[model samples]
Target: MTDWLSASAMLLAGVIVGAMFLYGMRRRQDRSDLERADLEAKRDALIARLREAPDPSLERDAAEVLRKLDKMGVEAAPLGGAAGGLKPAATQIKGFLWGAGSVAAIAAIVFFVTRQTKPAAPADPLADLERSVQQNPDNLPLRDDLAKAYLDRNNIEGVSEQTQYVLQRNPSDARALTYSAIVHIIARQPEAAAAMLQRATQSDPNLVDAWVGVAWLNAQAGDMPRAEAAMAEAKRRHPEMAERLDQLMAHLRGPSKAEAVHVTLNYGGQARGMIFIIARAAGVTSGPPAAVKRLPLSTFPIDVDLSAADSMMGQPLPQKMRIEARIDSDGDPLTHDPKDPGAVAEGVVLGNSVSLTLK
Candidate 1:
C-alpha cells in the first residue's frame, strides 16, 4: 500500500509539472500577441496625428513604434524616417517545441525510476500441479498430470515416485500402467515393459501410448503383421497419431533399397532447433507432408533420413517430391516462423541424396 501511494504521488506531480509548462508557454504566446497589437495601434495613431498636425517628433515616434513592432515580428507599414538608427532585431524563436523533448525525457526517466524494483521470484512451471496434488491427494488425474510434467522435465525419480503412488492405489490405472511401462523400458527390462503395456492396452483400449508401445514391441520382434494391425487400429481410433505412426513404422521397417532419402544440411552456425525433413507431393507447398522425419535440435552439418515409413496414411510417395528441410523454431510443423532456417529442394527423387544450405 505504501509503494502504491508513493507511485501515485510521483505520477500526479509529473502531470502537474507538464500542465504548468504547457500553460506557461500558452500564456507567453498570448502576451506576445497582445504586445504586437498594442504597438500596431500606437503606430497607426501616431501616423494619423502627424498627418493632421505635421509634427516631426510624432514622425520619429511613429518610426520608433514601427521598429518595436518589427522587432516583435509583426509586419506593418514603415515610417518615412532615418534608416541608420537602430541595430537589427535578434532572431526570433519559432515555437517552444525545442524544450518539449527534454521535459518529456525527464518525465519518462522519473516515471520509470520512481517505481520500486522488486526482484521477481523465479517461477516453478509445475507449482500449480504440485499444489493441486497436495490438496487432493486422492485425485488420480492430478497425480498423472504431475507425473507427466515431471517426466517431461526428465525428473526420473519424480516420475517413479508418482507412478508408484498411483499404481499402489489403483493397479489397473491405464495411464499409470503406461508410465510404469515407460519406466521399465528405460530400465532396459523389455519383458516387464511389454507386460505393463499389454495390461495398459487391456485396461484402456483407447490409450494411444499403449497401442504405440504394442506396435513398437511387435515391430521390433519382426512381427510386421501384428505391428501393422496395431498401427491400423491406432490410426482408426486416433488419426492425429498418423504422422508419428508413419515415422515409427518407417524406422522399424528399416531403410528401403530404392526409396531411401538422405538429406545433408550445410548449416552455418545458426539457431539450433528441431529439424523437420518434409516431403510433399510434387509442386505442393500447403498441408501435411507426404513423408516426414523429425530430427532433434543439434549443432550444424546434421544428416537426416526420410523414407516411406515417415509417409502419412501409410501411403507411398510419388516418383518426384518437394523436400523441405526446416529448423522449426517452436517445434510446430503447421506454423512457420520466418526466423526458422529452411531450404527447399524441388523434384527430388525417392532414392536420391539432396544437399541443402540453411539460411
Candidate 2:
C-alpha cells in the first residue's frame, strides 16, 4: 500500500513540475517574441526610408544603415516570423517542446528508479508474503503466499481458493488452520481464529507461530490480558521464539507495521481512468483501497517498516506479491466519488509481477 501511494505521489509531482517548467519556458519565449516584433518594425521602417531616398550621399548613408538594419533583422528574425519564415517558427516550437519533454522524462525516470531501489516499507506480514511469493513463486515454500496476501488485504474474493489449496495438501497444516480462524475473526465470526489456534496449540504445542497468531487475534478483540498471557507462554516454552512473540505483541498494540513495496503501475495501451489502491486482508470484506489513512497523499510510495507480527500466520512473509491495485478513475479534486467520475486515461502495464529473488 505504501508502495502504491508513493508511486502515485511521485507521478503527480513529476507532472506538476513538468507543467511548471514548460509554462516558464513558454513565457520566456513569448517575451522574446514581443521584443523581436518591435525590432522588426524598426528595421522595416529603415528599409522603407532607404528605398525612397534620392540624394546620392544621403542614399549611400541610408543604404549603409539599411544594411546594418538588415543584418540585425536577420539575427532577430528567428525570434519572430519576420523573415526567418514558418520553418524557423516551427523548429523553435518543436525544440521548446522537445527540450521540455526530455527534461520531464529524465526527472521522472530518476524518481522512479530511486523509488524502486529503496528498501521495502516496514514489515507488513501481507507484504512480506507477497514479497516471498514474488521472490520464489515456484519454490513451494511460498505456496501460501497469495492466500496470505489476500488474507492480509482482506480480499473477499479468493479466500476459499487459497484455503482450499492449502488444506488439499496439508490437511492439518497449522498455517491453514490459523488463517481459517483469522477469516472467521475478520468476518466477525466470534473468536474463530482463537478457537482454531486453541485446537492447533493443543494438538501441537510447538507450533509457536499458531500461538502468536492467537495472541494477535485476542488482542484485536480487546482481550489484552489474554493476549499477553498467550504471548508470554509461547515465549516461555520456546525461549528461542521470544523475538517472534515480541513482534506479535507490538502489532496487537497498534496497526501492523507498514511494508514498503516499490511499485510502478504502467497501464499499458490506451486505458482510461486513474488507479485506486487498497490494502485489505485476503479474505475480508473490506472495500477497495482508498486514502482513508491519515497521512498526506504526498508521503506515499514510501518504505513502510513492518514487524514480524504483521505476517499472515505469524510467520514471515515470503517476499513480494502483487497486491490488488485497482485501476479506476481518480475523479475531479472537487468531487468525492473516485470510482466513476466519468474521466479516463491511457493504461499501460509494466510487467504484471514483482521482481523478487528466491532463497
Candidate 3:
C-alpha cells in the first residue's frame, strides 16, 4: 500500500512537471512569434517612410532598421520562396525533437515507478496447509496439522479457531485440548489454561505435554503443591523424561539449604486467602526477584524454605536477602493488587525463620 501511494505521487508530480514544461515552451514560442511580428511591422513601416521620402537621413534610418530586422531573423513581406517553407520545416523538426524527448522522459519515469511499486511475494508456510484443510474438510489429521502450524506461528486466534473446530468434532482430542491451553497461557489466563490442560490429561493420561503444561502453569500461578504433583505424575507416566523433569523441578523449587526461613503469618481474620512469599536481595527492589513461594492464608505460621528452585530463571538466589509475605486475595503470585492486603519484612538474612503479620 505504501509503495502504491508513492508511485501514484510520483506519477502525479511527473504529470504536473510535464504540463509546466509544455506550458513554458508554448509561452516561449508565443513570445517569439510576437517579437517576430513586431519586428516585421517596424521594418515595413520604415520601408514605407523610406519610399515616401528619399531624404538621406530617412534612408539611413530605414537601412539601420533593416539591418536590425535581419539580425533578429525577422523575414520581410512574403517573396513566395523556399526560405519560408524551410523555416516552417525547421520549426517542425525542433518541436518533434522536444516532444520525443519529453515522451522518453515520461516513459522512464513510469518504468522506474512501476518497478518500485511492485509488491513482494508473501512468505506464509501456512497457506498450503490452510488450502489443504479446506479441500479435506473431514480430515482430522489435516485439521490438527493446520492447528499445530498456527500454534507454531503464535497465531492465537487461528489456533483457537482451528482447535475449536477439531474439538467440536472430537472433544476428547488431547492434542487439540493442549493446543487450546497453550493459547490461554499465552493470553495470561493461567486458570483457563490449567482447566484445559486438566481436561487434556483426563482425556489421555499418557499425554506428557499436558502434564508438563499443567505443572508449569500451576507453578506460575503460585500453586507449588499442585505444580509438583503434576510434575510427579508426568514423570511417573514417562520415566524416561525423569532427567528433564528433575531439571524443571529444580528450577521451580530453587536451591536446597541446610537452614531455611519458616514464615508465620497472621492474616488478621482473613480465613481464606493466598499468600506469596518472595525473597529478594537486600535493598534491590526493582528487578527480577530472588525467589518466590505461594502459600495459603489458612496455613499460617508454616515452615517456608527459600531455595534455588524457587529462584527465577537466570537469576540465582542471594546469600543475604529480604523476605516478604503478601496476602493476596486474587491468587496471583506475580501481581500485587493495591486493594489486596499484604505485609512486607525487609533486610532479613537467609537460613532463619521470619514472622510477619498481615493487617
Candidate 4:
C-alpha cells in the first residue's frame, strides 16, 4: 500500500512540476518582452529630447535613464556602449534557472512527504481470524470457523489443531471423535481408533459412524465376528445410513495412507477439579437454553481442562458440549455479582476462567 501511494505521488508530482515549469518559462518570456519595450521607450524618449533641446543636461539625463534600464535587467544595447547588453542577459538566464530548480526541488520534497504520511493498507481478515484462533483456541465458534478454513487450504496441521479443540470441549463429540478416529486409523493405530469409536458410540448410540469405526478397527485386527457384529448393529440403528457406512468402511480398509495424528483429550490435566470435555458438530450453529448441560462459562466458572487430549467415557460429557470444566468450589457456589458485569469477567476462554472464587 505504501508503495502504491508513493507511485501515485510521483505521477502527480511530475504533472505538477511540468505545469509549473511551463508557466514559469512563459512568465519569464513575458517579463523579458516588457523589459525590451521599456528599453525601447527610454531610447525614443532620449532621441526626442535630443531633437527638441540639443542641451548637455538632456544628454546627461538620457544617460541616467539608460543606467536605470541596465539596473532593471533589460537586455538591450546601450546608446553607444562597447559591450552590448551581455550583463543583463546573464542575469535573466541565471534567475530563470535558479527559479526553475527551486520549484523542482520543492515539488520533489512535497511528493515524498505526502507519500510517507499516507496510511497503510488493510490486513487480511482470514489471517487475522487465524491468529485469533491460535491465541484463543478454546473459542468453539472461532475454532469451528478456523477448522473450515484449514480444510479449504488442505492444511493438515491446522485441521488437527481445530479437531483437537472440538474434542477438548466435548471429548465425545461425534464429529471430532469420528475425525480423530479416521486420523488414527490412517496412522495405523487401530487401538486408538477403536477407543475413539467407542467414545462416539457412548456419546450417541444412534451415531452409525461410530459403529462403522468399531467395525473397521475389528476388521483390521482380523476379528471378523466383532467386525460383523458391529456392522449389524450399525445397520439396525441407522437403516438409512447403512450404505454410506459400508462405503466408508471399505475406504478405511483400502491401501495404507499417511495421516497427521494427535493424542485424545487428557482429563488428568484438570487443574482445579474434574474437567469435562464436550464435543459439538463441526459447524453447529445454535444450541439449547442455559441449563446445566448448556451453561455458558461466564455465569459458571467451570475449571474444565479444555485442551485435554483424552476424555472420560464413564459418563457422557454433555449433550451440546460447551462447558469443559466445573471448578468445584469447597462451599456452595455464588449466585450473582453486585458490581458491574464488565468488571466481572464473563465467558472468556477456559484458560482465563480458572479460579476458586468468583473474582
Candidate number of the best lDDT = 1
Regarding TM-score, does 2 or 4 come out ahead?
4
Off by over 4 Å in 1: 1-125, 255-359
- Candidate 2: worst-modelled 10 consecutive residues by lDDT: 290-299
Model 1 gets an lDDT of 0.73
lDDT of 4 by residue, 5-55 (tens): 765666566556655656666677677657766676877788698998698
Which scores higher on lDDT, 1 or 3? 1
lDDT, candidate 2, 1-359, per-residue tens: 76566556665665666566566666766776576566567656655675786567656654664455465445533344545545545655565566656665765686678777987767767767667766875544365556666765657445656666667777676666766676655443445566777776876687666677678777655688888988898898899878867876765665432433333333323334443332233333245321111111232232222322333344433233223343333422222343431221122122222321111
Q: What is the TM-score of each candidate against the true structure?
A: 0.42, 0.32, 0.42, 0.35
In model 4, state the lDDT of residue 85.
Answer: 42
Write the number of the candidate with greater lDDT, choosing between 2 and 3. 3
lDDT of 4: 0.52
Against the unseen true structure, what C-alpha lDDT does each candidate score?
0.73, 0.53, 0.70, 0.52
Task: Go through the candidates in order and give the C-alpha RMSD of each one to the true structure.
Answer: 16.7, 23.9, 9.8, 16.6
Candidate 3, which ten residues in sequence have the lowest lDDT sum? 76-85
- In candidate 3, which residue pairs get closer than 3 Å at backbone N, Cα or C atoms, i.e. clash? 252-309, 253-309, 253-310, 254-307, 254-308, 254-309, 254-310, 255-307, 255-308, 255-309
Give Cα distance to truth, residue 77, candidate 3, Å: 5.1
Q: Deviation in angstroms for 136 in model 3?
A: 12
